[model samples]
Structures are given as structure tokens and as C-alpha cells.
Target: MASLIDNNSNVCSMEEEIEAEAAVLKQIQNRLAEKMEVGKTAPPTEEEQKEIDARSIFIGNVEFGATVEELEDHFKGCGEIVRTTIPKDKLTKKQKNYAFIEFESSDSVENAMVMNGSTFRERQIVVTSKRTNKPGMGAQRGRGGIRGGIRGRRGGQQTVVVKYVYVNGAAPRGRGGFRGGRGRFNPY
Candidate 1:
């Protein structure tokens, strides 16, 4: 009888918790539905992006714990620092071990490039001109991941990757030959 009572109490508590969770979820769903009715903010235009890229220098091999202030201080000698960006992982929200520092003048790019391979926080950081982002990120559309076969294309240079390319028509389909007997895979 006591075990029965305990089981009933546990079931009751679980039911109450589930009802509470469903109510909270419904409230969240309603809020999201209301918000989705509004227009989303647009991304930066191409010309604006080009200007930013021209002023920006990508800082690679940055320490995970490095702050924006420290990066600005380190690169301030090059020119007037406009903005410093250290991207964070979407899920973990931690620094991605790289940063971008944008100076007010494009000329500062050369000065910052001079600091390439210099030690910063015990790590040799690479400073380079920011490469323009490929529109589709190697994908046919802006849909998902990079499609196979297309290696890369940049600065009027084309790169292709091919594997197991057979000059003849079809590959030979045959059985294998075992070592015990002269069993070798024959491509006939």
C-alpha cells in the first residue's frame, strides 16, 4: 500500500511538471510567432563589405582568452583602430581563437602585415589582408556545405580536385583472388 501511494505521488508530480512545461512552451511559441511576423534586419551590402575588408586585417592563431582591448592595444601602433572583432562559437559562446582588427586607414594594412609571425601572448600570430568572402562559401547556393569536386577559385585562379579518375570508360568489375590460392582482385 505504501509503495502504491508512493508511485501515485510520483506520477502526480510528473504530470504537474509536464503540464507546467507545456504551458511555458506554449508561451514561448506564441512569442516567437508574434516576433516572426516582423521583418528581420538585413545583412551588410557588398560595397560596405569591401570597404570593411580593405581596412581589416585578419589575426590568426590568437589565444582563446585574448580580449578585444588587448588586441586593439597590440595593433594600435599600426594606425587608428576602428573596430576589433573576435568571433565566438555559436553553441559554446567561446572565442574562436582568431580575430579581425579594422583600422581607419587602408595604409595601416601594410604596417599590420609587418607584425606577421610575431609573438603575442606566447603565440606566434599571423597577420594578413582579409580575404573577400566567397558568396556561396563553396556551395552551389548559399544553402549548406561546400559541394564536392570544386576545390577553390580565387584571384582568377581555378583549382580542381580529382580522385580515382579512370581514363577508359567503365571500371572493371571482377572477383578477388585469395593468397592461399592465386586469389587477386582482377579489374576486368
Candidate 2:
């Protein structure tokens, strides 16, 4: 009789715990919905507008085999495509899984934005405005950095010295010559 009572209490406690978890989950869902509503009602700021240009759209999750022609065809209804740029791997020369599409007008950007989360080549693609970096902005170049090329301090300004190294038709020759004294240092 006592064992039966204990089992009933355990079941009741389990049901109460489940109800409590469900209530918490419902609260979280409500908060998320409210936040989403707030975002939808708020207008984008001027700085954000400048950062995300009106005519450029970023397409993400592009398939490896997807071509520029296919992308143009898919977005034909949006508007006239001015240009499309798909960055490739420097060494492999393969598509980088994302592309930037520039439209003829800002209306095209708005049209494309409506197609966010749309299907493309069996995958849902993310479409968003392309963020543009202003001139003289972004990461500060380090001294002697290869990207900005060996910058030197001059008067209160930094001057970059660009050097180009060229190798002629013949193989490069070192201090020991082309073949490089192979048998000179022998280990027995």
C-alpha cells in the first residue's frame, strides 16, 4: 500500500515538472516573437543604409557547381543584373560558396530581399544587402605587412614601399650556385 502511494507521488511530481518546463518554453517563445515584431516595425538607420547599398545583394549558400548564368536566370524577375562577382579560392580556383549581385536599380535590391530563404539548387539560400566598406576604413595595416607592402614612417605619415621581385628565364642561382654543392657536406 505504501509503495503504491509513493509511485503516485512520483508520477504527480513528474507531471508538475513537465508543466513547469512547458511554461518556461512558452515564455521564451513569446519573448522571441515580441522581439521579432519590434525589429520588423523599426526603420533602418541612415548609417546602415549607406553600409548596405541599395542595389547590391549578397547571396549565400551557393552551390559549388552553380554558375553565374543560373543565378542571373533565377533572379531575372527581380530586375536587370548589372554584375555578379563570385570570389574564388586563390590556390584551388574554385567558387567560394557565395556571390554578390549588383542590380540596375535599388528596386531590384528590394525585390531580391523578398526572396530571402528562397530555394536555389536544392538548398535554401540567404539573400541580404551587401555591406560596403568605406575608403580609408577597416583593419589598420601593420608595419612591413605584405598586404600594404612594407610601410615606413615618414614625417607623421606612413609611406608604403612596393617592391617587385622578378625571376628571369633561367633557374635562380644561390650562393653555392644552381645545383647547390650536394656532395660537399657528406655524412658517413
Candidate 3:
């Protein structure tokens, strides 16, 4: 009879431990859900909004060796350049073939647009106004908005499918025998 009672006590304690663990798991899941909801609904701060509204232009197809001085010289006649930013690769520290040029005023944006399709370093460059999208605002067209509408499905879950094609494995002949392949040595 004593052994039976001991077995019952052990089973009851195990059930209680399982219940406690389940409650802890439920609490963690609730906290994660709350954090996600907050992140989705939070609005941009004042500084971020100002940055989004700043008069800037995105320059694509920039030459890998292009310098900020060259960009300033190209747009010097248009208007005062407030700032310039050229994103570089993390490992290579080379230009990512794009840059952002902020002008003193919105009017300068139009002036800078005249350089669209112009040649720089033997490559035709594209210049366009830079803009940001506010959350929950849907698609806002015209100058500053992103090109085309933001495409998404319900529940905010997206699945991306990618396909890669391999070309002939030959080292491209140019620019001091730089091997042109998808690796650390290749700058392109």
C-alpha cells in the first residue's frame, strides 16, 4: 500500500512539472507575438521622416572606380550638394555601382535629372529621385515613391524562388587580368 502511494505522488509531481513547463512556453509565445505586433505597427520617428523627405537622387550604374569628387564635379553646376553616400561591399570595400546625392533643395532635384542617361566612365548612368515608403500607406506613386507598387500577400509571409545559370568558365580579359567570376577576387 505504501509503494502504491509513493507511485501516485511521483505521478502527480510529474504532471505538475509538465503543466508548469507548458505555462512557461505559452508565456514565451505570447511575448514573441506581442513584440512582432509592436514592430509591425510602430511609426517612423521624426528624424527618419525628415531623412525620407530630404531632397535626394539615386544614381545607378555608377562606375566602380568613380569617386565622390567626380560626382560633385559632375553635378556642381546643378546645385549645392548637401551630402553624398556610396554604399560599398562589406568584404571587398568596393563601390556597389550606386550612390545617393542629396541636394540643398527640391528644385535641384530637377536640375540633377538632366544628367539621366548620361555617360560616366564609359557606362550610361541613370539618375532618379530617392523616396521612402511609409508603413500602412499602401502604394504612393509620383516622385519619391518606389518604382511600381510594393507587392505582398496576406499574412505578410513571402516565399522567394531563385534560379541561377552558370556561364562558360573563362576569366574575362580586361583591367589587369582580373578574373571575372562570382567570388571574393572578382570586383564585378
Clashing pairs counted in every model: 3, 0, 0
TM-score of each: 0.53, 0.45, 0.46
Say which prediction, candidate 2 or candidate 3, comes out ahead on lDDT.
Answer: 2
lDDT of 2 by residue, 1-188 (tens): 99999999999999999999999999999999999898575655777556437689999999989999999988999999988888999999998999989888888998999989999999899999888766676665554333433334433334445344547755334432222233243333
Q: Which stretches of candidate 3 lie over 4 Å from their true place?
A: 1-53, 133-188
The local lDDT score (0 to 100) that residue 17 gets in candidate 3 is: 100
Clashes of 1: 3
Give the candidates in order of TM-score, highest first.
1, 3, 2
Q: Choose the strongest candidate by lDDT.
A: 1
Decreasing lDDT order of the candidates: 1, 2, 3
**How well is each residue in 51-143 modelled by candidate 3, as lDDT tens digits?**
645678999999989999998888888799988888999998878999989888888989989999988889999999887655677743432
Q: Which pairs clash inside model 1?
A: 177-183, 177-184, 178-183
Q: Model 3's lDDT to the true fold?
A: 0.77
Error of 3 at 18 (Å): 53
Q: Local distance difference test, per candidate? A: 0.82, 0.78, 0.77
